[model samples]
Target: MTKFLKTSLGLVAATSLLFSCNEFKVTQETDGSKFQIHEKGDGKTTAKEGDIVTFDLVIKAPNDTVFTDTYKRKEPIVMPVQKGAFKGSFDNALTHLSAGDSATVYVSADSLFMRVQQPLPPGVTKGSDMKFIVKIKSIQTMAEFQKAQEEKKNNEAKVMENYAQKNFPNATKTQYGMYRVVLKEGSGATITAGKSVKVDYTGKLINGTTFDSSVGREPIEFSVGQGAVIPGWEQALMMMKKGEKSIFFIPSNLAYGEQGSGPIPPFSPLIFEMEVIDVK
Candidate 1:
């Protein structure tokens, strides 16, 4: 019968999500590296700087207790092997390692990582031996890596701009030190040089989820181009006619670029449906 053992890491961290794995098979090692690790992966793999690697690895503590193993986590660990990106035992182990090379490198617990890490079971100190199994899925050069990142950024920017135009037909934009909206259609009220307007608006996310609203809640009263709202919004509302419901699709640049609006993360494209209920 192929029966697997149910296991926990040790005496202290019994409730810790960090757990034991099958790969830490406990096959006695003479060196007492204090732990064991194995990989359920293809024999060998390669890696280079700036490359992203996914691997199924197992790690165990000196007392034959398991701390973590990719097998138990049921997910491959994604590591970006770059100078500032990686540090400590894991990074050191990956240094200069190419595709197809398998290692059972032993590391002292203290040397394991150089990051803000959670403390393991009490007494698990530096110099405690640990074992690991690493398999490199692939490698990419710095140029290739940066290119991919830029492409993703560009695509996202394009998507935000495209979505803004589609959702807010009256979304005109110009950057004069500060983002401003120039024109807005469908506002029913006659917008004069100076007018106090009260508007009802429902703002939504790209997915059409409402984030902010003044509909059936309370009427928002403000002067047009008074800088009370976002730049795009200020520009849009100034040209709106009273009694008209206008939809404003605004890009992050004209709205909140890299820094999104309330509850909205960075780079979020905004969609606002507004009605100029009154103009005084």
Candidate 2:
């Protein structure tokens, strides 16, 4: 995740440099000190097949008023720029870019959706010219990236077991390696053998350290059979019905197998005190 953060940060920082640098239109003979792209790149700029990309993009009008910038987001937006994900100039500009390339294109105001609160202020056409600079960062080959990341996280969940042990001094066992001292059941969720359901839950390592919990602000809604909840959650919750509450001490393999996220280390056990808030 930090790596992803760094890549986004780098993309945003690139835009800041534009303030002091000269704009370069697309050309082969352009100086190498800074990148100058005129016509959009002739490759796949829109992310496809799980590619992660970072780029410095600029939007402008014929009058040169800047409209939007990803730099303001402070993080390079990450997403697969697929068909229908973006329309108009944003989509058109990306249609011609590939990994690590940049481009500047003129998008008609009509295509890019430029808005004016007041009257057109004289001669601005409804489909006036809009300018933009774009760059492509990195690309992944498949959606397996999410799964790979999850596996890496599972490998890191080991440190969480100690957290549960330290905190759940009196936690009792339920079914499928789950445990908790009962709180108000409050009418939990109902589950069939092969149905999807949502749940509110929290998890901690054995050392009383809490790893994660959705019990604070709002109840979490997720499908039971879908990979939405962890394996342990599905296993434990399957034994429960509406209004059921239990304490669950999940083994590492059942939780995050090896990799951890933010705080939990690899191969961690989790103890959850859960109340089935709702089910569907």
Candidate 3:
């Protein structure tokens, strides 16, 4: 997760050098860090510690060498605001802005790398500065965020339930809230934890959009109880025997949950048609 944080926060170095830094009067933070606000927001509320923040970020090195830009990726980061690991850290910088504000914060590269316990990248020196360009998109209190998340979860559950009822009314619901319909029963003992299994699967969204499949390719193999796959897949596979073919309706809680992967949307329930070919 530390690596993920580093990447998401745009700590890595990028090859392209773009955007020239313009001169502006710098405001010194209480921690001695400096930032220049390019745009002031009209928001009345300021972000506080423990608040959930959604924002776009761009990290750059000297000479405007881009490290990462969330705006280009079109995925704004959403995270809880916490105290900085050091005086001039990004976390500390966030508290100084409100929704819709745009600012560029400057921090020492040495201190920044030290906080994340990562070695400085090539061409970066100890006393050099790293630039963080941030755009505040939204902020919500913990209670408000939790309430919204609960509402989204409930809505997703209803969607999945409706889809299951309409398509596979006789599907068996699992303890983890997923539904499964066995298409073909396999012979021999049921799969157990630590056993290696080979499977071919086609995964789809509730809207019938296929995201991934193993058709016309080598079947994927993994050991049961290993974290190589989602919890739903492991649970469902454990309930089946060799040669069994089943379709699983996996709820977001048992799958990707709030932070969806690549093409999957947040709070999305997934559908998978799976066949266990071999168990050893």
- Clashing residue pair totals per candidate (backbone < 3 A): 12, 61, 0
> Which portions of model 3 show Cα errors greater than 4 Å?
1-26, 38-42, 63-76, 116-119, 162-195, 200-219, 225-228, 238-247, 256-268, 271-280
Model 3 agreement with the true structure over 1-280: per-residue lDDT tens digits: 9989888666333312222233345778886667888887866768899999988899998767888898776567888999988888888888888888888999889998887799988767779889999999888999998898778888987888888999999999898899999999999999999999999999998878778899999999989998989999999998999999999999998899987885576788999999999999
lDDT of 2 by residue, 139-253 (tens): 5545655665566556543434344467666765555445555555545444754565556777666556665677666877666766777787777767677677777777767
lDDT of 1 by residue, 1-280 (tens): 2232233334335544235544454433332222233443343444555676655566667666676776554445655775433233555556445554445656656645434465555546565766666555555566665576456446765776666556545545544222223234444446864688888888777786667788779889987766777877776665577777766666665677664544564556677777877888
| TM-score of predicted structure 3 | 0.63
Candidate 3, number of clashes: 0
lDDT sort, best first: 3, 1, 2
lDDT of 3: 0.87
- In Å, residue 276's CA in model 3 sits off its true spot by 5.1
Minimal lDDT window, size 10, model 1: 176-185
* Number of the predicted model whose TM-score against the real structure is largest: 3
Model 2: how far is 38 from its true place, Å? 51
lDDT of 2 at 3: 100
lDDT against the true structure, each candidate: 0.59, 0.58, 0.87
lDDT of 1: 0.59
TM-score of candidate 2 on Cα atoms, chains taken together: 0.37
